[model samples]
Target: MSGHSWLLKLPLGKCKSTFNLEKAVCNHGFFMMAPNRWIPSSKILQRPLRLADNTTSVTVLISHPPDSSFLCVQVYHSQTPSPADQRAILKQVTRMLRLTMRDETIVTKFQSICPEAKDINFGRIFVRPLSLKMLSSASSFAIAGKRKRAKSEKLTTHEANNAAPMGNFPNFEELVNIDESCFLEKFKPILGYRAEYILELVEAVKTGRVSFQDLENSTEEQLCYEQVYQNLAKIKGFGHFTCANVLMCMGHYEIVPADTETLRHIRQVHGMKNCNKKTMEEEVRKLYDKYAPFQCLAYWMELLDRYEYKVGKLSELSSSRYHLISSVLFQEDTSNK
Candidate 1:
């Protein structure tokens, strides 16, 4: 069994009308659970059958269950191996893919594609829920110091107890409630709203006893968007843009998250007239089956929307990005294996 690793490109052309990249990789020989779509691994492996005359690329992508890292693997091959060998190589590739996809950087990169996502700030987004003890011993180093640890060496606390410092454990709301001044004092060199503003907003709420309900109850006239966002920013150490983002975190915004481009195209180009929330959701889910559960679905939708807005038809958007990726399929010799 000779072995080598390299990044591979996706092979084009297939006949299946509903060709699913995510399902093809994630399923258990078409006999497993309904494949929940997501990005196929960024890194993949390809093994060629000695008798077959085809090239293959196996790409894999995974997301954490709620608060886990994103995993991606992309494998390319210039040959097609026998069915038995292909299965064996796939098992090995998946094992490594699982580990590499868990890298914090990979997770952040994946989330960054979400339409609602503003940025990927490790300290503010994923590592702020650390307990004092856990922070000092585990999380503090990740957020404060300059030491390099293995990618897998994360700072997570026990689930049952506030035992260890964890990374990306805190939800968006929790991130907004950290101590701003204290965080700034500890990590002065850091310069961003998340690291700085999130803490400030949290402190303001605590100091003023402003529960989440208060933010929601306030009227459009009583607390205009600009006013509310500005108030959030003025908290000691918070910036203007950061405060606006915090308000959204507090459930004040109507931002729908997905890969905007594909969604937009599905409607505009695909002749989806008067697409409502439910329609969008269903279509988005279907595309997720096609594209996998990518956070960038919003991007795909947005591109379609823009195309229709400009050309008065979805054809422009259809001919390129969305159409190409969504339509093609590969006919592997499942009959042999």
Candidate 2:
């Protein structure tokens, strides 16, 4: 990609577009997911957006009209960007700001299908693992083959390798294990199995063994959901929970993925104990069956409620103490009033 400049217009107003800025960005799950190492501003979300081709990532700014009739985007680069650069940026932009060119039907359909319609932004769709556009002076920009130094202390080789850039991941021996160890050592307290699950998907996408783009663009004639599900299921570490999460984030919510967290949630929210997988699946389906294909979204929001998190802006959680974040959520506050 070369370095160049252009103003991409989101044609919403000419078509009566009402893109609520806050509702739009908060739905991406990026804000709630500080653990992923991507950070964003409250009003204007800026992060490093990796090109689909994975050659390099560029930092971009996202803002809109006062009425937010259209989304205005300007991609910044160190050099002139190639045609591929613009296309890649546009694809990412489309995925991140799903309301850029949408019609009223999109919101209508989303609200009707989502179980907890009042809690989520019906008009927005989020990309799995999410996309970020880096800002100047961000420490992550140096996380490639060369690692970034912490202001307090010099990082070891293991830390350096584990934080290696996506492109440099393949160079590491057993890329999967490197990701696993990073989670175990650095992020294990909060992430638990989720680190391995997301890392599995990330490594697969980064290395070209699993292509998010290919699956996204495949026509039903080219590849059906069953075939896609089977292919994802074959990945060494992705079981039902991980596969459903990846697929649901990709916009397929036919089935809601349930795990121990869900069982605990049922105990808290619905007083169900000893819920078996079969029974659990049946219960979730019946509960959100009216929403039909969007049961997963319903299930996800309800689980979020159990964690005492509403669908809204995110706050930073200290890495060392993150394991205790959830504990604070459901714990009763019986301090003297």
Off by over 4 Å in 2: 1-8, 12-18, 34-42, 51-53, 80-84, 99-107, 113-120, 123-125, 128-214, 217-224, 271-278, 304-325, 330-337
Local distance difference test scores for all models: 0.33, 0.50
lDDT of 2 by residue, 1-337 (tens): 1223345555554333435555555443454443233323435544445444443555555566576556665555544546775666666666655543332454556566663564454444455223322211113222223433221122235433322222211212233335455556665567777756657665776687876455555422345455666767877677888777766655566566787656556555675655556688776666767775566666665665444352123323323544564555445221211
**Candidate 2, residue 19: lDDT:** 55
User: Weakest 10 consecutive residues, lDDT, candidate 1?
Assistant: 120-129
lDDT of 2: 0.50
Q: How well does candidate 2 match the true structure, expressed as C-alpha RMSD? A: 8.4
Query: What lDDT is reached at residue 277 by model 1?
Result: 54
Q: Which candidate should be chosen as best, given TM-score against the real structure?
A: 2
lDDT of 1: 0.33
* Model 1: per-residue Cα lDDT over 163-190, one tens digit each: 1211212222333434546667765565
